[model samples]
Target chain A: MRDDVPLAATAAGGTRGDEECCTLATGPLDAADAQRLSEAFKALSDPTRLRLLAHVADQGCASVCACDLTELMGISQPTVSHHMKKLVEAGLVTREQRGRWAHYSVVPAAFAELRAFLDLR
Target chain B: MRDDVPLAATAAGGTRGDEECCTLATGPLDAADAQRLSEAFKALSDPTRLRLLAHVADQGCASVCACDLTELMGISQPTVSHHMKKLVEAGLVTREQRGRWAHYSVVPAAFAELRAFLDLR
Candidate 1:
């Protein structure tokens, strides 16, 4: 049995023929999009990371500094850095360096895309 | 340092007083809710499982049969069964057995809750 199905060439939930299906409910998710979504989900699979994300997101448009995260989370600089790195790599959040510290903000589009997928209606 | 945060009594993105905050944007995510959200995300971390979810979701309220999934995914019956189990455990999908076949349907509320967290705006 060919259990190892080949990844679909089309982007995840991309135009499948004439139908304009984007979310999971609209149609089958392509392999490429699945890979991308899975990575983002993986980044959010950890409790600590989720908390950190919540803290950063709580700040709204205001970016949270790495130094502040160290105190808020009561974790070491490296621990916060590690989690922040994962969040940034997953495209869930954006990172910017301002002076001596790195600031992070939620990428609204990313969450919206994920929310759209779950919105079955 | 108390890096290991104790789980909060409130639900994920639940009320923090009269403030009426119900999402990641409003306030910090408690450990209890973080663990729940992380587990749900863990279920979506697999590409194969995600594809399966999309397929099930595509069916909408109609529901998808396990036998059909085996053929649709081009994977073994056992493999499909395994993945389905995880989705079911994660509360991403609901399963019902009819006759000799197992049917699966997406859980809208579960996805809605997860989507709310990502809805930073």
Candidate 2:
């Protein structure tokens, strides 16, 4: 996953304000970058969604069945589907539909992008 | 700042499920840690808050005056105050009042803790 990603470009979305939002690299998170990142974090703001992320990451980012996620969360199937949609929209997790079920996993580059700005030694 | 922090203790509140919420170290983000992290990220979930963080950080963790933030954001003083209050509650930023105005700075360890979990390459 790391090999496929050009780290700099991933964080800085070229013409977008990605270059500016570097918490450590440049200045403050630029407007464009802030807009993008805020959406990602906003999706993560909910407790249920965080739990879903935890479950997926726990399975080693393996494609966890959406049905199992609904069971673990004890939320309605529609509610789980809603949370998954948000995560997918945020680009934090990927969804793969196997027949009637959807599988979820973390997007490493997305997590890495968030982690990098906070990495000031 | 880091030396004072017992990283384990910080991440895992003894009574809380901090140990269980390990996105990398353990299986899932336990309920307690998820609650905590979700709040922190929730504080960051807004564009205005993200901008405030960026502005404060751009100053090299130096204390930023509330007045300056108000002007920079082009928002009402009350709105800026509200956002800063949320950041403080989330433990992402520190608030220091010098006379009538408040000064803000980043909480390094807080950011570090968030980074650690996402450190899995």
Candidate 3:
């Protein structure tokens, strides 16, 4: 819901040479970072969205069309669009137009940031 | 919300030697796993809860009392208790009672499962 907090910026921020590790165990998270992560996690908090994302991620280097997702997930096109919009806005997924349909792919950096944040060591 | 999908069972399921890797990139998640993960993610979807979890995780080997979290997060006792309840129910955090106050700690395996799920490899 907090689209104001961009996952791309947080992922980029984590890579700066002097930056401290972004894991939750390292230290208390500031409000801004917490906002960003909570937004990303919220985008992932739905079962339908998680399955949709997994389908896309499972494709590896290949991208999947929105129409294919609707068919695959057995959901309406509008529902797919709604979930995809949330994922793209949260920066976990990227959308690109190919002809009339939109194609999506997982943004590796975003997932990496999330994974890094969960690191308890 | 959907607390029926226990995270401890999922974390334990991941450790079975014959089990497939749990990363989202590897395969499509089944309905049950999706339900479980969504519940965990939903619990983490709030900013206050994320900061609260981080504070507990930052303690490493130690646990923090609920009273201490109320003071550190600058929130009222009820708010802290509410967030803590969500975290504990999701299996992302553990609760223990010592005398009058509840103590909390991060569940490392729960976080490891989340981190693993994000793997885009």
Candidate 4:
């Protein structure tokens, strides 16, 4: 998603402070924000990706290497890497390089934001 | 989306009690469960659907009628009805017919399940 468009613009223009009050309700969502959020959810639409996220969360503070993921997912190394990259881009997981292996961990804030987005009456 | 296949199957089958501990990380997800969950996310992938959910939620405990949704969404009556049917099928919203009008409200439990599904870390 492009970062050029600001989220505050699409919000009902009353006052700058009032933007927070005009949530997903009140009116139509900003096209850019909706597209961005949809992309995140699309990335999560896959079961493999969901499993990967769960793996990282279950590890607590520890991270899982690419090699570890390959066996766990029953997928090829490149496939695992691709999924990891998608997760990283979606901000659902963070990757750190440790020598030759890439270690991945869950990003709690990203998940929290997604949860907040899903909140309904 | 079929409810027949149990979630406990693909989980590492050490014991029935161990199923609860498996979570999404321990092993590959059951194909049926993944498909069902994917369909739910697919139903929610649309911006219009998200807006509908948000509107119902913003109304607090009150429900919105089909006529109200058509005005708010600027969509045709049939289109709104179709979206409402899909939302009801996904369990994201519940519908109650008030005479000729159908009043729809958010199903908090369904949204909660979705939020829980998105829990990464």
| DockQ-based class of model 4 | incorrect
Writing each residue's lDDT as its tens digit, candidate 4 over A63-98 gives 667777776667888988998899899787778876
Q: Please give, for residues A1-121, the per-residue lDDT of candidate 2 as tens digits.
A: 1234322322212332323332454456778988888898898888778888877766543456777777777788788889999999999888877677777766767887877666543
Model 2, B6-118: lDDT tens digits are 32322212332333232454457778888888898898888888888877766543567777787777888799899999999999878877677787766767887677655
TM-scores for chain A over all candidates: 0.78, 0.75, 0.78, 0.72
Judging by TM-score, tell me the better candidate of 2 and 3: 3
Name every residue pair that clashes in candidate 3.
none
TM-score: model 3 vs. ground truth: 0.80
For all candidates in order, the CA lDDT equals: 0.76, 0.70, 0.77, 0.63
Off by over 4 Å in 3: A1-25, B1-25
Per-residue CA lDDT of candidate 4, range B39-107, in tens?
667666676766666666565455667777777678888989887888889777778876777877666
Screening candidate 4 with a backbone cut-off below 3 angstroms (N, C-alpha, C), the clashing residue pairs are: none
- Residue A79 shift from truth in candidate 4, angstroms: 2.6
Taking the tens digit of each residue's C-alpha lDDT, what string does model 1 give over A1-121? 2335332311223213323222355478889989998999999999999999988777655567777788988999999999999999999888888677787777767887787767665
TM-score of each: 0.79, 0.76, 0.80, 0.67
Q: lDDT for model 2, on a 0 to 1 scale?
A: 0.70
Score residue B105 of candidate 3 by CA lDDT.
71
Q: What is the lDDT of residue A19 in candidate 2?
A: 30
lDDT of 3 by residue, A12-49 (tens): 22222323322364478899999999999999999999
Report the Cα interface RMSD of each model, rounded to 1 decimal: 10.0, 14.2, 13.7, 11.5
* Per-residue error (Å), model 4, residue B107: 1.3
